[model samples]
Target: MKKSNEASCHNRVSQQGIKVQLEIIKTEARGWGVRSLNSIPSGSFICAYAGELLEEKEAERRTSNDEYLFDIGNKYSDGSLWGGLSNVMPDAPSSSCGVVEDGGFTIDAVEYGNVGRFVNHSCSPNLYAQNVLYDHEDKRMPHIMLFAAENIPPLQELTYHYNYVIDQVYDSSSNIKKKSCFCGSSECTGRLY
Candidate 1:
């Protein structure tokens, strides 16, 4: 797999399963990454993307440097685009389908988050996000979850697709947003967004 600015990717085991843990590993060339301390089976729960949940307008009021915002407001065609990664991530867990509709909340974890924040982005990923509403019936604020898309070996770095659509996002300078993607998958798009 190719390398990304981040060394690992965030994952989840359950909505309230913060105890489900993995280890953070540092790579001299890749910085810090998340890795399984042991073997993980396919379709297993990893960890939830964790953070501060925000309303649509409130999230919009923040800066455009959306590196850690998870849009719990929209629906996607598949689990691939689940949670609509804005820039960064948070916590959730378990199996649920790809998506449904949400009220208008965004999860921001830049400062407030868990180990799940350590997970990285990949053009090709071993993890998948599923929106689950186990915590409350709000539906607007369902837990954004991650699960193993495939069985992972011990010490393997966890990764998931960021699902960014080229040219749709802009930076604070109003310029087209672009972050070099080093996640070495053959499907790598070269740019993060």
Candidate 2:
């Protein structure tokens, strides 16, 4: 079990309901696009993920040998980054994205969960995940924040760059080279794996 916090800005359309409708698009390299579910102002949370927390070892052990797509990047003394993000376990089940050590807080229900998982990669992206520091009642634990990278219009699919740009720019090995992009945005580079 893991915990997280409230992030993302939401508009109340009705007393009983809140609606965010993001678009999905398919491109040549990056297959899916997620855009503003509505007209999103800057600094908004579209949606989030809730799931069983797994150590990198656990996540790796759980993924079958064939599921190459699940790989996140390096794991720190306490975390790992792959599949477009670092290993994030929030303090509350419903807390915003963050990491934890052996002992941290917990939450019962996951509020907005895992909407970003399906968002594919782009060399040129319309969306990005912002890392934020969350201050809590308990100062000992640290929290992380995620947000949309840019303002988006309705009906546009959301997207983020899958690879770190600095690594891409400085990496010398052909192995680390980025796969071409096919998002079909006017900026599409047209080659990806």
> Which is the leading candidate under lDDT?
1
Q: Residue 21 of model 2: what lDDT? A: 70
Per-candidate local distance difference test: 0.69, 0.42
Give candidate 1 misplaced runs (Cα > 4 Å).
1-21, 28-30, 76-103
lDDT of 1 by residue, 73-129 (tens): 554344445343322233422224445565478889888987777788888888877
Instruction: Locate the minimum summed-lDDT window of 10 residues in model 1.
Output: 86-95
Q: Please tell me which predicted candidate would have the highest TM-score against the true structure.
A: 1
Tens-digit lDDT track of model 2 for 34-53? 56548865445555423344
| Candidate 2 stretches greater than 4 Å from native | 1-19, 23-29, 62-113, 131-146, 164-180, 184-193
| TM-score to true structure, per model | 0.74, 0.46
After superposition on all C-alphas, the RMSD of every candidate to the true structure, in Å, is 10.2, 10.2
Residue 43, candidate 1: alpha-carbon lDDT:
67
Residue 121 shift from truth in candidate 1, angstroms = 0.4
